[model samples]
Structure formats: C-alpha cells, structure tokens
Target: MRLLVTGGSGYLGAAILKRAPATCELAATYLAHSIAQGNAAAFRVDVRDADAVNHLFDEFRPAVVMHAAAQMTGDQMLAVNGDGSRNIARAATRVGARLIHLSSDVIFDGEHAPYDESAPPNPISPYGESKARAERVVLDELPRAVIVRTSLIYGFDPLDPRTRQTLNGEMPRLFTDEYRCPIFVDDLADALLELAQHEFVGVLNLAGAQRLSRYEFGIKMANAFHAAPRFTGALSASYPGRRPRDCTLDISLAQKTLRTRLRGVDEVLQDLPGF
Candidate 1:
C-alpha cells in the first residue's frame, strides 16, 4: 500500500510510522521537525496551505491517507484543524485515496456519556469545535472517509505530552471529574493501520476499553513511571473555561469489527516492569 501520514513528527504519527508495515511505501508530512523512521520518506508541507497539500498529494499519490495533522489549541486551531482537514480531504478525493481522519472525543458536550458512533457532535470548547468542524468538512469532501474518533493517546516509549507534563510538575491539578478512555498509543496505531486496508467508512469510536478520570489516569502514569504522584485532584468546575466532564467513548463497534485489541490504560501500565 502507498500510505501518507500527516503530522509525522507528532506522537501518534511517529508511532504509526514506527509500526507501519515494511511492504508499504510510506510518506509523511511535517510542518517543522522532520522525521527519519526506517524507509519512510518525510516531506515538509503545511497542511494549512491548500496549495501545498494538493501539491504533495499530487506528487505522492498515496493509496491511503492518514490525516493526523491538527492544531489542538491557540489562535490557529480552526485554520489548522478545520480548514487543513478540508484541504486534505479534497486532495485525497482527487487522488482517490482512502482517507482515515483522526478526530477527538472532545467533540461531544460531555453531558452525554459513553458516546457511540451515531452520537452527534455538540462541542463545548474551541478545541472540540475545531475537531467537529474538521469532521464535517472531511465528510463533506470525502463521504467514504473513515472518521476515527479517539481519546487520550498515551505510551511509555517516549512519554506522551499529558503524562510528561504531569511528571515535570507542569500540571498543578488533574481533573477528577473529567472522564476519558485513554488508549495506548501502540493500540491506536495498530487499529488505524488495520482500518487502512479495510473498506470501513463513516464515524468509528476507537478508544480504550476502560474509562477513568484524568486524575486517576495521572496517578496511574506516575505509579508506572516510578515517580511520586504529586498532582492534586480538582473538579472540572475549577477549570477556567468550559470543559467536557465525560467524553468517554463506547468502542463496542470497534471491538466487534477489528482484530486489534484496544487495551486500557491500566492494562497498558501493568505492562511496565515492576508495576
């Protein structure tokens, strides 16, 4: 398969590159930091620029496109996540490539618990709104595209951002009420690869089997890291802006469909030595 992965420098993108099949012709795009994983060719292209995206798509002409490039926050969120997604979708459509766009659980308002594939997006925050918009544009451009909505992607190989922040004492308080199904990065990568070959389209919730609060996830990470967990628990209300309280996903469809086992955070943590 000729595969193209955007945001190759990001955590999940890097993991995918590392685990992708050797038989596949791999190509990845990054805005700044370039990657050198195996034989995967890295291209520096800004997804925000439609011309650049189209040019890369024309050159690579991938059989499958994993659109992982996104801006989670700040002023460029909408432009990067929403408009960038539209550009990728249109480019992939032109090339007749199977598009598997990564989405987030934050799209829901959190008033709804254990969201399934059919759950309509009711974003509460800017990040969520941007992702929801990304989903809409991607679907509009490529109706057959697989919109994979996932949760907190964590891995120990090169500690994920959230866990690293907590370990470095950058996070003062972890939310006790905010619930999510944090998937192991490896599991998510494997699942995405499996999805690439399949004909499955539309929204698919691919998250961890277990759901837990952010505080619980942090404590587990600290314990697994063999560091003293120091962060205090705080309710979502204490958070400055509106935060999703229960963005937990229902991965029953994914569980039933794919052979890839989506392990939970607890199971993943236990895989560590002396855990």
Candidate 2:
C-alpha cells in the first residue's frame, strides 16, 4: 500500500513513518523540518497552499493520505488551528484520496466526562472552533474521510528539547487541577495506520483510557523515567481563557474496531521499557 503523510517531521507523523510496514510505499511532505529516516520519499510543501498540495498529490498519487499537518500555538489556538486545517481538507478532497485528518478533544466544552463520536461539538476555545470547522469541511467534501480526535499526546523527543523539558519538569508542575487523557505518540501512530486500513468514517476519539490530572500524570511520568516528581497547584481560572474541566474521551469505538488498543496510564507505563 502506498501512503502519503503530511507533516512527516511532526511527533505523530514521524512515529507513524517509523512504525509503518516495510512493504508499504511511503511518501511524506513537510514545511519546516524534514524527517531523515523513512522508507518513503519526503517533499517540502505547505498544506495551506492549495497549488503546492495539489502538485504533490498529483506526483505521489497515494492510495491513502494522512493529513496530519496543521498550525498550532499555545497562546493563540484559533488562527492556525481552525483556518489552516480547512485548507488542508480542501486539498485532500481535490485529490480523491482517503484522508485521515487528526483532530483534538478541545472541540468539546469539557462539560461531559467521556465524549463519543456522536457527541456534538461545543467548543469553548478558539483552537476547538478551528478543529470543528476543519471537521465540517472534510465531511462535506468527502464523507468517507476519517476525523480522529485525540488528547494530551505525550512522548519523548530527542530532537525537541521543549518536549523533553515539558515531560521532565514544566508538564508535571502544571498538572494539579488540569485533567486529560494522555496518549503516547507511538501508540497513536499505530492506531492511525490501522484506521487508514478500515472503512470507518466521521469523528472518532482516540485517547488513553484513564482520566488523570496534570499532577497525577506527572507522577506517572516521573516514575516511568526515574525522575523526581514536580507539581504545583494552579486554579483553572488563573489561565487567560476558558477551558473544559475534563476533556478526556471514550475510545470504545477505536478499541473495538482497530487492531491497536488504546491503553491507560498504568498500562502504558507498564509497557514502557526502563530508560
């Protein structure tokens, strides 16, 4: 099977490239950083540029296209999150290729405990609004397209110092009142590939099984990595914008349909080899 992955250098995309079957013909595109190791060919293209995206699509003619590229920001989530995704969706539709678009749990207002694919999006943040809009474009353009909504992705990155620091220090400290279901990037990559093989369509929540506060997750990370635990309480109100109290998702659909099982914190930690 030939597959094209956008955002090939990203955390999830890179992991997917690494885990994909050796027989699969892989082609990837990136805007900023390029992944050096993969069986697939890599191209530098901006997803927002329809012409550029189309050019690559025509050249690759992939059986499956994983649209993982998007613009994101910690301070401003809407501008890149919502608008940028729409552009990618448009290009994916134009190519008549099966698309698996990555989405986020932020689409929900965080009122409910565990949301399903049927849950109506009631986004409270600009970032959420962007993903909601992106979903609409994909469904409208291609009903067969899959929208995977995941949350709190955690993994170690040798090249990304920020990710390392966040996992080792800042992330644990932020976790007091904040709660989320964190999925490991490796597990998520496997799931995405499995999802690509299925005929599943529409929004599917891909997340870990357990609901943990930032503090609890930090403790788990520390234990897994043999690092000292660091946590400090912070009120949700202290943040600049409104956020859902608990945005964890229920991944029963993915677990039942896909080969990769969505694991909880304990399960994931147990699987983690000593490093």
Best by lDDT, which number? 1
Query: Which window of ten consecutive residues has the lowest lDDT sum in model 2?
Result: 157-166
Which residue pairs in candidate 1 collide? none
Weakest lDDT window of 10 consecutive positions for candidate 1: 266-275
TM-score for all predictions? 0.98, 0.91
Q: Give candidate 2 misplaced runs (Cα > 4 Å).
A: 74-80, 157-163
lDDT for residue 9 in candidate 2, whole number 0-100: 82
CA lDDT of each prediction against the hidden true structure: 0.92, 0.78
Candidate 1: regions farther than 4 A off? none
User: Candidate 1: TM-score?
Assistant: 0.98
lDDT of 2 by residue, 1-275 (tens): 78998889887788889889887899998877978665779999876666777788788888888888775556534544555556666666776778898988888898886788898889887678777887887787778788999987777654234336655565534636667898888789899998888888877889988888766776776667776655565667777889877887989988888889888878877876664
lDDT of 1 by residue, 1-275 (tens): 99999989899999999999888899999887778575688899988999999999999999999999898879999999999999999999999999999999999999989899999999999999999999999999999999999999998778788889998889989999999999999999999999999978889999999999999999988877779987899988987899989998999999988999999887777775667
Which prediction has the highest TM-score against the true structure?
1
lDDT of 2 at 236: 76
